[model samples]
Every structure is written in C-alpha cells, then in structure tokens.
Target: MNKLISVVAVVVGTAAALPASAQITSGSIAQNKAECQAQFRVSDLNGDNFLTPREISLFRGSMPTELSGREVIHRQDFISACYATLPQDD
Candidate 1:
C-alpha cells in the first residue's frame, strides 16, 4: 500500500511540474487583414484584383454576404470583411 501511494504521489507531482499549454491569441486587425489579403491574392489566379464567382467558391462561406449576388469580389471589400466574417483564434 505504501509503495503504491508513493508511485501515485510522484506521478501527480511530475504532472503538476509540467508547463501548461499556451492559449491561442486573436491576432490584431492589421495582421488579419494582411493574411486575408494574401489569401485573396493567391486565390485571384488571374491577377486582376477581382474574384469571380468561380474564385469565390474557393472561399465558400468565408466570403461576406454582400458578395452573394455580385459577379465579382473586389480586393478592398474582402479586406474589409476579414475582421468580422473570418474565424479568429478564440
């Protein structure tokens, strides 16, 4: 019984000494905008700074609602929505 208790205590102590996992940070607006812009640039494909319906499909639900009926998504509009529409680290 004493040996079992000692082993259990040691295991608990070792676990307590280990570092806790780091929490993810919600990035600043500027950082988020930059990231979104980069993704948009890659998805643009044609370098026209506008995403057509087919390109918009790549982003799926991440695109802003204002773009629903539009034929194309402008770069500025996408950057504007990044803060509110995109999922952030919580």
Candidate 2:
C-alpha cells in the first residue's frame, strides 16, 4: 500500500540521516576534549600530571565566566564539564 511505502521511505530516510548527525556530534565532542586537554595541561602549572588544590583554584579563577562556577573537585570531572562551555574549534 502507498501508506506502507511512505512509512518505509520515512524510516529509511531517518536512518540515513542518523549517521551523519552522529559523526558531527562525535567530531564536536572530540574537539571539545582536545581543547579541554590543552586547558588541563596549562592548569597543571607544576608540570605534574595531577591537579592540586592550588592548581584547581588558579584554573577556576581563569576559566571563562560560564565555566567558572562549575564544580571542579577532580581533574576528569573538571575537563568533562569544561566541554559544555568550551567553544568548538573551527
């Protein structure tokens, strides 16, 4: 029936669009992570792999206004949350 064919077409079209959207999303995530990693490195002022309280405070102080107030109790958590506020690289 025409209704069945229309449904199939819609489903197929949607499925085809999904991968493209996913690629875009993943790419943005990757870029965000890269930026956060750079920030983390800069924040690790002592050259240690870990972020100490002083480093965290300094980093938080320098963070953009939007990200300045987020909980940054741990390195991973801080980086992950930074993704939300870090601008996507062109």
Candidate 3:
C-alpha cells in the first residue's frame, strides 16, 4: 500500500514537473531521494527517521505550508513518497 502511494506520488509529481517525453534518469531520482532523506534526517532532530509529534509541530512551525502540516509522517512512508516525488535539489 505504501509502495503504491509512493508510486502515485512519483507519477503525479513527475508528470506535474516534467514533460511526457522528458526522460527521468535514475541518477536524478537517486539524487532527489538522497536530498529528501538528508533534509528529513535534519528535521527529525532526534535522528529518528520518523517525525515525533513535537518534531512535526516544529517542522510545521518553520514550514507551515505543506501537507506535513496536516498529516503525520511515519519515518518510512513519507521518505518513500518524497524521494519519489521531489526533484533532485528539493
């Protein structure tokens, strides 16, 4: 189920960001996922991949504009979706 969600997020994000004919290279995807992981790891504060309630609160405090503000992010699940959906620099 999580895998499916991740796939859908990737498809949606990619389609929203890229053209149908535009090829998404593996390196690009890997790089994007790495970046997302790094950012999340930093935001996690306690080094847990999952965001605690406090961590989530603080994250929303700082970035108060995203879906993370509205939903809890399990350590594993959001990483999967974000790495799949976000761009390399994101």
Q: Which pairs in model 3 have colliding backbones?
A: 50-75
Poorest 10 consecutive residues by lDDT, candidate 1: 21-30
What RMSD does model 2 have?
17.7
- Who is ahead in TM-score, 2 or 3? 3
> Which residue segments of model 2 deviate by more than 4 Å?
1-31, 47-49, 64-72, 87-90
Query: After superposition on all CA atoms, what RMSD does each candidate show versus the true structure?
Result: 17.5, 17.7, 13.3
- Which tens-of-lDDT digit does each residue in 9-84 have in candidate 2? 6434533454332222111222455555655555555555666766556455534444454444455665666676
TM-score of model 1 vs. true structure: 0.49
In model 1, residue pairs whose N, Cα or C atoms come closer than 3 Å (at least 3 residues apart or on different chains), thus clashing, are none
TM-score for each predicted model, relative to the true structure:
0.49, 0.41, 0.44
The top-ranked prediction according to lDDT is 1
List lDDT for all candidates, in order. Answer: 0.56, 0.51, 0.50
Return the clash pairs for model 2, or none: none
Instruction: List the candidate 3 regions with Cα displacement exceeding 4 Å.
Output: 1-31, 61-72, 87-90
When summed lDDT is taken over every stretch of 10 residues in candidate 2, the lowest stretch is 21-30
Between prediction 1 and prediction 2, the one with superior lDDT is: 1
Candidate 1 lDDT over 1-90, as tens digits, reads: 996586456434543443332111112222454456555554464567898887676555555565577778888877676656656788
* lDDT for each residue of candidate 3 in 1-90, tens digit (9 for 90 to 100): 996586456544543454333433322332355555544544455554667776566445322233454455666765666655655552
